[model samples]
Target: MIESWRWYGDLDPISLSEVAQTGARGIVTALHEIPYGEVWPSDTIVARKAQVTEAGFDWLVVESLPVHEHIKRGDGDLSELFANYRQSMANLAANGVHTICYNFMPLLDWTRTDLEAPVAGGATCLRFEAVRMAAFEVHMLGRRAAEGDYSPDVLTKAAAWFQRASEADRDALLASIMAGMPGAFDRYDVAGLRVALAAYEGIDRDALRQNYKRFLDEVVPTAEDLGMRLCVHPDDPPRDILGLPRIVSDGDDLAWVLAAHDSPANGITLCSGSLGANPINDVPAIAAQVADRIHFAHLRNVTKDPDGSFEEAAHLEGDTDMVALVKVLLDEQSRRRAEGRADHTIPFRPDHGHHMLSDLGRDMIPGYPLIGRLRGLAELRGVISALSHG
Candidate 1:
């Protein structure tokens, strides 16, 4: 496994030089400048690679090249859109960027109800509160019959939560819930958000899965032809939310995807933090089973909730046994090497870290504070080294 950190390009508050100093050699990032449907030009790829390399880090992973909404819906001009995606991957591979990490979550990126949920050690971690999201869906955004998405018990609970919230609290909850999740909030107003959620109400999980297959069917072969690897990130929270159907959540879901497309280019980004939010997932088993096709890994953990809520946990302290997971990857790599396989080493980046120590005041991406991640990478580095030697 190669040590890496997720670095949002140019716009990130943490500089590339700072990332290099964290003892990580690879930097995972994306071209945030390119719009969703546009091709990432070769020149753009070179410029960002130059930026990171000059600052003493290798540009090893592409955190995302967002799947366009049109492609997701199988709507408006999908052939052209998929072509653009293929071109983007070709551009990346041509520049020596082989691994790509992306997600197929609908309507939103990952959701967080509170950006500053305080842990016992005075570190602020990102949290997912089901009630708060329900409040936004039912009361703040005023989606029609949003209660139907929840069970009878959750509906009653969310009603009480909505009644209890004051005006300011409701506004803050809405802001936290809907700031930038694809077409919902970034471009739409309150009404448009409601309309967007309503559109997905009828698209059940099975139907959504079909749409995803349609996407992969067109895109994966092109990727294989380009010699690029596409590692699809698992859905965050790993369940349906805001009426959007979540397809990539559990072991069965991933198994179905692998069965559907038997291609190396169509692989997975095994994110422990995201998948571990569901206690049911046996993390190491999943990794080791699919290790041959697993191209990228996002290593982190979470403290899960019964109500589908969760918070980021310390690297070694969460529900996930990260040390054992790392050993699994190492074992898989060793097996591959013995078999004389090429591209045996998998790319891994420390997923989300807490806001700890003096980082509380600094403006950075939620759960991406420096001190905590630096601490985590250092711990993981020692764990792997000791295990290998012993």
Candidate 2:
């Protein structure tokens, strides 16, 4: 696989030289300065590519060219937004960017309740405790029918978690959940937050699935025409959150997505942390089954607790078998090479590392501190090297 790291460009506290030092040859980034739904001009693409190339790294993939809000609703100027997205993909291809990774999660992007949950090794990491999340929904934000999303036991746990939270903790929890807002519900006010959560009251898993299908129908053809691979990243926690449905969690979901578009261009990003967050996901099997359409990868892990709580783990630790999963990707790469594909290796980045070492005290984005991801990239590179040699 092409070793890469996710860079937020110049705005990221972690510099490009630091990323180059991490042993990654490629960068996954987007021009975040541009507003969503606007066309990413060819000049901007060229300039961004030049920036990464100047830093001694290739632009591996567009971490996202965001799916616009109108497109999500399939109304209110959606055609224009979709046209802009298509033009952006075409512009990206012309500028030598090939793989485009995106997500269809409504409202927030991959969300979590706690950005610094304590782990045993003295390093705190990003976490998604179902109880903390439910507490926010039921007690803090008060989303109607939020109780239906959790089982009785989980609800009990959430109630207990809320009871124990200090006022500061609850406030921080809200901030963490709303951090780096993405998709339909960014910039929500207090009343807007209520309406936003309430809006999902009747949209079940199947309805969200239909919306995703609608999205792919518009973009996948353009992606195919321009030789771009469209990879949909799975839901971060691999489950429903705050009464919202998650569509890209399991095999069945993937099957439906692939069948919906019926094109190789519409594929999966195959994020290990996202899928492995659910204990039921057979990681190796999941990768193998989706190998043909696996255009990008995000390699990371978490220590899953039975109480529906989990904290991010180092790349080599946690329940995910890093080597076994890499082996699956490697085999897929080898097979593709054998068939004379243009790009054999699946593009991957070491995702969501701990904020540790010198990065521990830095008030950077949660799970994106430099030294921590540097360590993760090194670990993943070592595992891949060993597996390739073995």
Best by lDDT: 2
- Weakest 10 consecutive residues, lDDT, candidate 2? 182-191
Tens digits of per-residue lDDT for model 1, 1-390: 789999878768898778878889889999986778889999999999999888888888898989886666656568788888888988999999988888888878787888888899788888888777777778777765667766667667888988988988776666666643642226555677777766665677777788889888987887888788888899887877777778888888888887778898889899998889877898888887777778888889898877777899988989889988999989988998998978888878778788988788899876688888998898888888988998
Candidate 2 lDDT tens digits, 1-390: 998989887668888877777888999999888889899999988999999999998898998999875555545457788888899999999999989999888777878888887766667789987888888888788765788877789888788988998988887888888874873236665567778766555667776777778888888998889988999998888887766678888887888888899899999999999999988898889999989999999999888988777889989998999899999999999999999998888889889988776777777777787877878888988888899899
- The TM-score that candidate 2 achieves is 0.95
> What's the true lDDT of residue 163 in model 2?
90
Off by more than 4 A, model 1: 144-154, 179-189
lDDT of 1 at 330: 91
For each of the candidates, give the backbone clash count.
0, 0
- In candidate 1, position 266 carries an lDDT of 85
lDDT of each: 0.82, 0.84
Compute the lDDT of residue 70 as modeled in candidate 1: 61
lDDT of 1 at 124: 83
